[model samples]
Target: MRRIYHRFPQQIDLDFELARPFRDVLSCIARLHNTHTTSKGSGGLVKERMIIQVADGRTQFLDLDDLIPLSEKTSEAVDFRVDFQRTLLTPEKRLPVAENVFYLRIVDKGPVTECYAAKESPHGDMDAMDLRTFLKGACE
Candidate 1:
C-alpha cells in the first residue's frame, strides 16, 4: 500500500482560552430547532436533538472533538457533537468488537503516529483507542 508520510503535522494544538466563546455559540445552536418533549424529573428535559454523524474514513476524528472546545459538552450541545460510530451498532443489543472492551472500528490503513522516525513502525502505537461518547451518558 502507498504510505501517508508524516511530512505534515501529526497533532493539533488547542487553546484553552478559546473554549468559552465557542461553548456559548454551540449552546445557542442546540436550542434553536429541537422540540422539548417532557422533563425527566431531575435529569432535566429530553428533546430530539440534531446530531452530526460524521463518517470518519480518513481517521481525522482522532482530534475532531478537540478541534472544538469540548470542555463543557452535553446533550444540549448535540449539534456540535460528532459521533464516530463508523462500523455502527445494532439497536437490538450493544455489541463489542473482538470481545474486547474497546470497539475495533477499523484496521486503520493509516493510523496515529507521534513522529515518522527512520524505524517508526506504523502499527507501533495501536490506533484502537477507547470510544469516547460525544455526549455525556447519551452514547448508544
Candidate 2:
C-alpha cells in the first residue's frame, strides 16, 4: 500500500506527497506529460484518488470525499482523492539531471499493467509513464 498526504478543504492551499511505489507511479505520469503546474501553484495536483479492483478483477475509481476528514477513518480501511494537476510537479530541467515529477491518468483495470495515458484524451497523445521505472530512479 502507498501513503499520500493532501491538504484539506478544497478552498485551502494545494499540497500533497506520495511514498514509495505510489510516488514512483505518479512520477512516471508526470515525466511523460511534462506536467509542472496547477491551480494551487507550480507544485503538482492536490486532489486525492485511488485505483481499486473488485473481486471480479474489474477496476474501480474511488475519490476521497472532501466532506469527510481522513483522520476519522479507523483501522478497518482508508480512502483518499486524486488531483493530477497538483501531484505531478514540473521537473527542473536546469539541473545536470532531470528530476522525476508526477502525472495523472485513468487506468482501465489494473494500475500496474496499464501504460502511460494522457490526463485528457482531447489534449493529445503524450508519453506514457511506467511506474516501475519511476520507482527505480525517483530517489537521488
Candidate 3:
C-alpha cells in the first residue's frame, strides 16, 4: 500500500511581496483553513489519531508528523518568493495592480491528489511576469 500524508491540525502563516502592484491572497487562505479531510486504510485498517478543526468551519482527520517537514519546506520557499516578487515588481507600482498577494496551498503529489489555493483574484495580462510560475514554484 502507498503512504499518503493525511490532513492534520496546523497553523500556517503565508506572506507575499508588495513592491508595486497589489494581488489577492484571501481566497487561498480561506480554502486552506477550511477544507475537511480524513486518513484511512494506509496502514491497513488502523484507527485515526489526530483531528483538524478549521476554526470557523468543519473538522478533519490528519497526521501531525507529516505536516512538520512539509511546513518547514513551505516556509523556506515562501520567503524566497517574497523576495523575488518584490524585486521584480518594484518599478511597476500602480493602482489596479495588487501590491501584495499571499495564500496557503495544499499539494499532494499522489494519485488522485490535487493542488488547491485558499484565495485568488484574476491576474490581468502583463508582460515581464508570470504569476502561475511564482505560486507553483513556491508550493512545489
After superposition, candidate 3 runs with Cα above 4 Å error = 1-68, 71-98, 107-109, 118-129, 135-140
RMSD of 3: 20.0
TM-score of 1: 0.17
* Model 2: ten consecutive residues of lowest lDDT: 49-58
Off by over 4 Å in 2: 1-59, 63-83, 87-126, 129-132, 138-140
Top-TM-score candidate index? 3
Question: What lDDT tens digits, residue by residue, belong to model 3 across residues 24-69?
Answer: 2222322233233232332322221112222111133233233333
Q: lDDT, candidate 3, residue 91?
A: 32
C-alpha RMSD by candidate, in order: 17.0, 14.3, 20.0
Candidate 2 residue-wise lDDT, 23-132, digit = tens: 34333433333233333434543332223211111133233332123223212112222222213334542211122222322222322322222222223222224333
Query: Model 1 misses residue 95 by how many Å?
Result: 32
lDDT of model 2 at position 132? 30
C-alpha TM-scores of all predictions: 0.17, 0.20, 0.23
Q: Is candidate 1 or candidate 3 better by lDDT?
A: 3
Top lDDT model: 2
